[model samples]
Target chain A: MTPLRHVFFVSDGTGITAETLGHTLLTQFEAVEFKTTTLPFVNSPEKARSTLDFINFIAKDAGLRPLIFSTTVNDEVRAILRTADALFLDLFDLMIHTIELELGVASTHAQGRAHGMANQQKYNSRISAMNYAMEHDDGQSTRDLARADVILIAPSRCGKTPTSLYLALQHGLFATNFPLTEDDLEQQKLPSSLRGLENKCFGLTSEPERLSQIRSERRPGSKYASLAQCAYELRQAEQLYRRAQVPFLNSANMSIEEIATMVMQEKNLRKPTF
Target chain B: MTPLRHVFFVSDGTGITAETLGHTLLTQFEAVEFKTTTLPFVNSPEKARSTLDFINFIAKDAGLRPLIFSTTVNDEVRAILRTADALFLDLFDLMIHTIELELGVASTHAQGRAHGMANQQKYNSRISAMNYAMEHDDGQSTRDLARADVILIAPSRCGKTPTSLYLALQHGLFATNFPLTEDDLEQQKLPSSLRGLENKCFGLTSEPERLSQIRSERRPGSKYASLAQCAYELRQAEQLYRRAQVPFLNSANMSIEEIATMVMQEKNLRKPTF
Candidate 1:
């Protein structure tokens, strides 16, 4: 068994930048076992001291020096964190310096600016998109299907809701998902409400075995979770895609982020350019 | 005013990692103007060539070498991206290699693995959390507030929804949010559904000016969106927080990411440990 290593993502604010960059780097090293924790909003010397203590404790417990990925922008807070008995890595210093030199400007060294609230318009649009994604999820509100940037069509548990929500959160895209019911699959047609909006549609299809496994978690031992049913639904849905000339992708192997962005790229070509 | 420079977040998958890291880096250079675009799922050599073309076009139009921050893991795709008429930086290679040596393992060099479907449990939990957040949004369903990891309370448009969703999507945290309505503010008490769930409650307060500005966009010129109304609501909400002893953050300056993580850190201290 691979030795379990404790990893910490430390930041002065959300810790998202640290976590995302750290996780991406960590994903490459598949042989090691990494149990990760995030310590966010560590703005003060006191908080940094406690975080350092936490890292030390975890390192001692695991008999390994914890790997601390930090983006503590504050110099004073960062000084306290540097005292931990671990292999510390600063995520921002070197890159920010290079960018600073390129632009011939000094950085503000402010906290929470990475994802802070400055532009009200961008923020409001993101919230509105989130509400829109939920309101129209699973074919609930097809009334304003025309207004959606992209309408995701997929069978139950085929990753429509999460993908739609991801698009809304990340891109501020008004993405709505419609689940293809068994009847629609059997009829080999899109839903009545989505008929005219076919141009703004994207389809998500997945493997039968994967679909079966996903469905089993929700409705154990039911026909809905059966392999045969999933195969039938996926086949019929793909046929509908081909007939309607709508582009689709297999989402069984894809993440919500992957599917959301890929859908947008496809949609971008067909939809009007901004 | 600073001259506009074209910026590109190029990635082999969702482009989220590139966009996020690039955005964080850009935030430090506050004085610069960056017109950024994301090029996602550029896995194929042809796609890479086309992305380079887009970068070149932006450079030609803007008369400045575009800054391209890429997380393209594929070597061939990366080579094509590097050939663009711009300054290019790889986001993951050096760090992943250093860690790979530390672990004495080779990287998979897989595309989409950063946010891919390697862990089924984590993916399902994220979806479950999204559903929980949606159901519990604005006190819509509070029958099982006990199940939530954190219940965010705030006045309308104070950013509870986006923060809740971001936590769910990123952390797989079951975060529910409730709007501290005018009725609750006037009564100066927690809502009936949230009374016993005080332990799980976290509050969000914002600057009255920012609140008014946010509200005015949604309900232009209405009394609810007026400065007096915003001031009164924020004052009452803060008093309620003091009475309930609920920990709160002024979200006027923080981003949704910052607010979510800070709320989690506060909730982490009070909630049970794993």
Candidate 2:
């Protein structure tokens, strides 16, 4: 068994980006056990000094160099953390210099600009998108169907709501989702509400075995959780997608982020040039 | 102004984390212009070789090395990428060696484990929480009030819905929110639906100027969007929080990520020691 090691993600802002990067890297090495901690909003020199001291203490106690993943952009604060007995991976300083050279421009070296609340329009758009996704979830509010940027059609519990919400939150795209009902599946036809709006429609399907496993958690031993039902629904959904020429993806192996992004990409909801 | 440079974020999995970290780092260099692109699920050696070739071509075209931020774990793939004519910063390879040395364990050298669909329970919990957040968003549904791990109270458009959704999507926390209506503000009392759940309640307040600006976009110059009304509502909300002993934060300067994390930390809805 591998010994547990200390992992710290420190940042001047929310620390989410640091944690996401650090955690993804750590997940690559399977045998190691990591006790990870995140310390956010360490924007000041004093705070950085104290955090470095704490990391040093942890290194001494463990008799190994603790791993540090940091995203602080301030030079004074970063200098303080460099003194700690750890492998300091300063994400900002590592690549920004090369990018500056390539761009042939001086950097601002400003703090808190990444996720700053400076753009009210973008922020409001995200909020409004979130609300729109929630309102139109599971075909609840079809009144504003014309306003939806992308409409997801899938059976119940096939990862629709979460992906819809993710698209809205991450990209400020208005997304709505509908659960394909039994009648629609039986006839392999688009739901009446979704007939005229096929241009912006996207479909999500999955393997029947995996879909059964997922449905079993919510409704044990019911027909809805049966493998046969999942297979039938998935087959009908695919047929509908093919007949209607609507682009679709199988969500059996992809995460919510992957599904949301692929739909956004193939449907041209996000401008790739941007 | 800086020259335009191509920036690539490559990953074996979803690539969201790599893009997030890279984007945050790039934001600090304000004067530089970046054309950022993400390539996800780069898990194979053949794909890695093709990606390297593309990167080298971009380098030759622009007369400068493109910047790549990658999280690929496989050694064979990393070696292929190292031959590219670009400044390669492989986030996974950067720290995995130190972690393996500290833990004294051989790595599994896995691919796609970062956001893989391995843990079904945790993934389902996140979905459930997102649904819960949507159901109880902005005083929408109070039926399952007690099921919420945290309840946020604030005036209209004070960043409640986004924060609640973030807490759920990131941490699998069941969060609900309600807007403090004018009657509650005038009386300076917790809403009747939220009175019993005061122990789990949190509050968000922002500057009157910012609040007015945010509200004016939704309701064009209504009393709710007036500066004086915003100030009055904010004052009453603070008073109510003090009387109820609910912890609060000023969202005027913080992002949705920061607000959600701080609330989760202070409310103990999450185990901070973890």
Highest lDDT against the true fold, candidate:
2
The second chain of candidate 1 has a TM-score of 0.85
Per-candidate Cα lDDT values, in order, are 0.82, 0.83
Q: Where is model 2 chain B poorest over a 10-residue stretch in terms of lDDT?
A: B265-274
For residue B137, what is the lDDT in candidate 1? 79
> Judged by DockQ cut-offs, is candidate 2 incorrect, acceptable, medium or high?
medium
lDDT, candidate 1, A1-274, per-residue tens: 8888778888887778888888877776777788888887798888988888888888888887787788878888888888888777776764677777766778888887666675767777778888899889898886777889999998998899888898888778898999899888888889888878999899999999999998998898999999999999999999999999989999988888778778877877222111
TM-scores for all predictions: 0.87, 0.92
Please provide, for model 2 over B1-274, each residue's C-alpha lDDT reduced to its tens digit, 9 standing for 90 to 100. Answer: 5467788888877777778877786775666667887877788999998888888888899886788888888899888988888878887666667656655666678787767775676777788898899889998998989999999999988889999998888788999999999999988889999878999899999999999988887898699899999999999999999999999999987778779878966886753322
TM-score per model for chain B alone? 0.85, 0.95
Between which residue pairs do clashes occur in model 2?
none
